[model samples]
Target chain A: MLQIKNLKATIDGKEILKGINLEVKAGEVHAIMGPNGSGKSTLASVLSGKPGYEVTGGEVIFEGKNLLDFSPEDRAREGIFLAFQYPVEIPGVSTTNFMKTSLNEIRKYRGLEPISSVEFLKLMKAKAKLVELDMAMTSRAVNVGFSGGEKKRNEIFQLAMMEPKLSVLDETDSGLDIDALRIVSEGVNKVRNSKNAFVVITHYQRLLNYIVPDYVHVLSDGQIVTSGGKELAYKLEEMGYDWVTNND
Target chain B: MAELKDKIIEKYTSTENLNNGEPVEIKHIRDKAKEYFRTFGFPNRKMEDWKFFDSKPIITNDFKLVTEKQEIEKSVLNNFLIQDLKANLIVLINGEYSKENSQIITERKNLFIGSLKEGMKTKPYILGKYFAKYADYNADGFTALNTAFAPDGAFIYIPKGNLLKDPVIILNILDSRKSKVLGQPRNIIIAEANSDVHIIEEYYSIGENDVFSNVVTEIHTDENANVQYYKIQNEEANAFHVGTTQVFQERNSIFTSITLSWGGSVTRNNLNSYMNSEGIECNFKGLYFLTGKQHVDNHTLADHANPNCNSNELYKGILADESNGVFNGKIMVRQDAQKTNAYQMNKNILLSDTASINSKPQLEIFADDVKCSHGATTGQIDKEQLFYLKARGIGEKEGKKLLIFAFANEIIEDIEVPELKEYLVNRLNEKLEKL
Candidate 1:
């Protein structure tokens, strides 16, 4: 589903992702674990085509197309979703309206008719139930004055709404408690299917217990030093990242 | 400068028969206003109050003062009124109220709605008590001009303890199809004790020729009365408008004013409210969206005279192309006005680098026990907000339009009238699309 060949990225003359390479097939969930300042978030940002990041000498291919040539919005229309580490608060824009606009825009790019109001409401209700989001929260401004757990849940709600082909969860478990983590992971697990893929990035192994990944990659000093299975996360959690970084 | 003044004087002298049976008090006020205008001529950039707003383009043109009312077709008048609005409609053609175009509910005994001229002839005693009382002619050149040439406008009076069921919409239409004209519509609204009323005033020009509309509205609210006033200016691009709204609030009265400026080449609004007694509340909100070479200036003042009064002010502006905007808001708390709470905020978004805004929020407090705060901010649309929207598959243009609409929606949502709020929202969307 996605391929990153010798991904070399930099910001302000400082290299962040140093020749990182990764590959993912359809229906597989990958977890990229690292300590602080290990360039995990940079990989997600580069995949999402954020501005001010210079791709020094690498290429990213998504679904048989060169992703680097597309703009951020075009990449979104092409089914690339990046759940932000910190969700933006857009005042005066209701979450319902925001989702409607985004869904319609993506549909328009794919030559689909706009959804009817009645159908849109039904869809909203069905998807919101998956994440346990309050109906009142959808009518209020998007993420304005929302709690940290609510924002994270809202991100999952959007993921359910968009149904993107490739979803990158960047530090989605940062500020969540145990209950919130369970609910959020349940939302992600429910939306998983054979046609999609997920790149879960986290600093800890707690989120993996709920939405278990097929493969685990330990990122250290801007490179993926080790790759293993689900048990590797528990091993790293018990011993710590130094077990791999010290030997490397 | 002298040529425009000479033209006004000539027109005033030639139209003597227009006010043949005017009351003696009214004639005296007119003469005094004329004298004041002659002494000061037109306000210049040299004056501190008129520094940012230059009056050169407005006063340089040789505009003929409209003395006779222009005939307008009923179909043309219906286009300006809100469709399906169940409110009393008062239409003014060329600054003169058209009785044939107005609809007033006579079943309400305490309600009085008619032309100002008719009100002067029928109830001159009541008109004389509040006319030119709140708007000081000596303070503003435009106020003096409107007073001297004031002939006819809308007059709304509600007796004590009467709550109006329907809103009153006053539509002022300027027909400059024949010549370059000047229309001054002077309005007075009086709400008796314990009464409630809502008013919506709008300006519309029918022609593409140069038209100057100078309007003054004075509102007097008695004890415990509630009033909501809205002023909407969406005239032709060749039009110029200078509007002054002065409100006086008695003990425990509540007053709210919303000013929306969407069109016109040069627009200036002076909105002032005076809280005379304790426990009074006042709110002043404004929104302006300008493009092309348009210029809009807003000056607002909230004067707290007694203890335990509160006032809030918020004004937002969106400037694109080469448009220019200015916002100057002042809140004053007198020495005896202890426990007064006042807040003022002004925000502007500039779309193009050539677009400019001058925002100034001032607070003057003589009472040490008062709580007062003021803020002014001017900047371009936030890049992060824009990118957030764009990253969701929305285009740059649509993203910008959405953000700008959201910025202005904060004030638009506060409108008490549902229909008017919806109307302004549509108008704002249409304005933002052209940008």
Candidate 2:
């Protein structure tokens, strides 16, 4: 579903992602773990088409389409979703209205008519139940005065609503508690299907326990140092990234 | 300079609304106003109060004063109607009230709802006491011009201990289609002790030629009274507008003013509130949405003269294209206002690189036990907020429109008038579609 070849990106004069090559297939999950300043978040940011990140070399292909050629919005319409680490607080935009606009835009991109408000409400109610998000929270401004756990859950709720072909979760578990982690992971597990893929980017193996990955890749500096099965996550958690990268 | 100042006499005296049958009290006030204008004609950019605004374009034009009232087209009147609004409508055409066009449904005996001319003739005692009482005509050139030359405007007097169930909508329309007409309307609203009322003053013009409207409204909220005033200026793109609203609040009174500027070439709005006694709450909120080459300047002052008073001011602007905006908010906490609380905020968004905004906050606090804070911010649409919307599949254009709409909607969200709120949101969407 996704492929990156020699992806080299730089924010300023310094290079962040030196050379990254990763292949993500349908119906599989990939977990990327790294220590501080190891380019883990940089890989996620580069894949999602954020501005200010210059692609000095190489390309990214999603669903056989050149992803770098599309804008951030077009990438999203093409079924690429990025769950932000910190959800932005739009002062006057209600979450329900935001969801409706996003869903209709994606539908419009797919040559479909806009969804009726009644049908949209039904869809919203069902998705809110799946993620255990309060229905009242959807009526308020997006992420305004929301708790940390609710913000993370809202991200999962949106992911469920979009049903994207590929989702990159960037540090979504950083501010969540144990209960919130389980709820978000379970919501992700329920939304996963045979034709979708997930790239879970985190620092600890605790999140991997809930949503087990098909393969674990430890990123160091810029390149992937090791790729192994789920046990590699527990090993890295037991002995830090120093133990893994030093052995590399 | 002499030629420019001498031309003001011929410009206004040419009108046929003479002093014949005018009250002696009204004549004295006009003469006093004329003397003030003789000394200081039109405000220039050199004055401290008019430093940012240059009145040359407005004062140099040879605008003929509106001599007679003209019939307003039914279509134009229909376009200004609020949907599902249940309120009293007062139609003022070319500065004078038209009873045939207005719908005053209230049959209360004590309520005197009519024109300023009628108020001067019929209720001399009431009109003489409150007219030109609060608005400082000796200082402002436009106020003097309006006082010396204004023919008529809506005058509402609610007697003591009465709560008006229906709001009053003063529809002021200028029929400048005939010529380059100028309109100056003076309005006075008095809510007696313990009375409450809400009024909306809307300015509309149907003409392609130049229309200049100089308007002044004075509101006096007596002890324990309440008042809510709304001023909406939506006229032709080339029209020039200068309006002043002065409010006086007594003990245990409440006053709220909302001013919305949607269309104009050059518009200036001044709103001032004086809290005279304790336990008074005053709120002044304004919003301006400008496109093309439109310009709007808003100045506000909240004076806390007594102890235990609260005042708040929030002004927001969205300037697109080459439009320019200016905001100046002043708050004064007198020494006697020991327990006063005042807050002021001015926020602006410049959509285009050429669009600009100048905002300044002036706070003069003399009381040590008062709480006051003021802030001003001017920037483009938040980049992070825009990108977040775009990343959710909304296109970049749509995302920007959404952010701009949300930014302006924050000010409109606090309106307590349901019908006006609905109408404004629809009108705002219509403008945002082009942006």
Candidate 3:
């Protein structure tokens, strides 16, 4: 479903991702874990085509298409969704309106008719409940004055709404409490299917307990130093990065 | 300076019946205003008040100051009327009242809604007391020029203890079909004690030629009176507009002014309010959405002369292309005006690289028990916000348009009238398409 070949990225003349390669098939979940400043977020940003991040030498292929040729907005319309680490507060734009705009945009790109108002409201109500979001929250400005947990849940709501081909959860569990983590992870699990894939990026093994990954990879100093199954997550969490790197 | 001034004086003295049926007092007042304009000439960039506004374009254009009244069909105005508004309509063709075009649907015994020229003859006492009273002609050149001409304009008076249910809509249309036309319209609105009223002034340029509208409005609110004033400027791209609205608030009175500037080549607005008595509330709100080479400047002042008064001012702008936007808001709290509260804020968004915005807030406080705060900000649309929208599958252009509309919606949401608000929302959407 997604392929990264020799992905070398830089920001402000400093290379962040150094020759990292990864691949994931449909119906599978991959978890990328790393310590602080190990290019975990940079990888997600590069995959989503964020501005200001220069891909020095790399090519990202998503569903047989060269993703680098598309703009950030185009990437989203092509079913590449990146749940931001920190969702920005946009005043005066209701969350429902935001959802409507993006849904119609994606539909247009896919040669589908725009969603009707009745269907939109029904979809919003259904998806909003998956994350336990209040109907009132959708009427307020997007992310304005939202709590940290509410923001995370809102991100999951968007993930459910878009139903993208490849979803990158970048640090979605960082600021969440135990309850919020369970809810957010459970929401992701409900949306998981054999036709779609998710790449969970996190700094800890706590979120993995809820949404188990098919494979686990440890990223250190801008490269994937070790790759293994779910046992790798338990070993790294038990012995720490020092033991994991020394053993590798 | 000499050329325009001499020509105006030549025409002011030689024109027959310019003062026909006009009171002797009004004629003397006109002469004084003309003399004042002659001395000050036109406001240049050298003057502090006119530092950011340049009147050179208006002076060099040689627009005909004396525009003849043009006969326009009623259907010609159908395109500009508010869709669902039911109000007393007063139409002015080139600054003169057109009885054939205006409609007065609501009338009371003590209420007066008609032209200033007729109001002066019918209610001389009211006109004699309120006309040429609050607005300053001595310091402002355009005010002086407008006062000198003081042509026919919309005049409305609400009697004491009466609530005006229907708002008065004044359509000031500039007919520049044949040549450059300059209009000077003076408006006076007096709300007696405990009266409430709403007035809307909408300006439009009908032709492609150069059109200039120099307008001055004087309003007086007696004790406990409430007045809502709205100005919707949808002029042509080749239009130049200078408007001055002076308001006086008595004890326990409330006055609110909102301006929406959507057109013109160069536009400058001056809105001032004097809280002369205790416990007055004053508000000034404006929004300007400009594209192309449009330039707009808004200057406002809130003077608190008595105790226990409050004034709040907020103005926002969205500038696209190489347009320019400017704002200067002054808050003055006199020594005797204790416990006064004054707040001011101005914000702007520049869509293109060349678009410019300038804002300055001035506060002078001599009262020890006063509170005042002001803030200003100018920048491009927030990148993080825009990216968030784009990441949701919305296209770049659609996201940008939405953000711009939301930015300007903060001002439009404060409109008190429902139909007007709906109309403005549609107008804003149309303007955003071009941006």
Measured on C-alpha atoms, candidate 2 has an lDDT of 0.88
lDDT of 3: 0.90
lDDT of 1 at B216: 95
lDDT string, candidate 2, B289-322, tens digits = 9999998999999999999999999999999999
The DockQ assigned to candidate 1 is 0.74
Residue pairs in clash, model 2: none
- In order, what DockQ does each candidate have? 0.74, 0.81, 0.81
Off by over 4 Å in 2: B1-5, B11-20
Interface RMSD of each: 1.0, 0.8, 0.8
TM-scores, one per candidate: 0.98, 0.97, 0.98
Better candidate by lDDT, 2 or 3 = 3
Q: Is candidate 2 or candidate 3 better by DockQ?
A: 3
lDDT of 1 at A91: 95
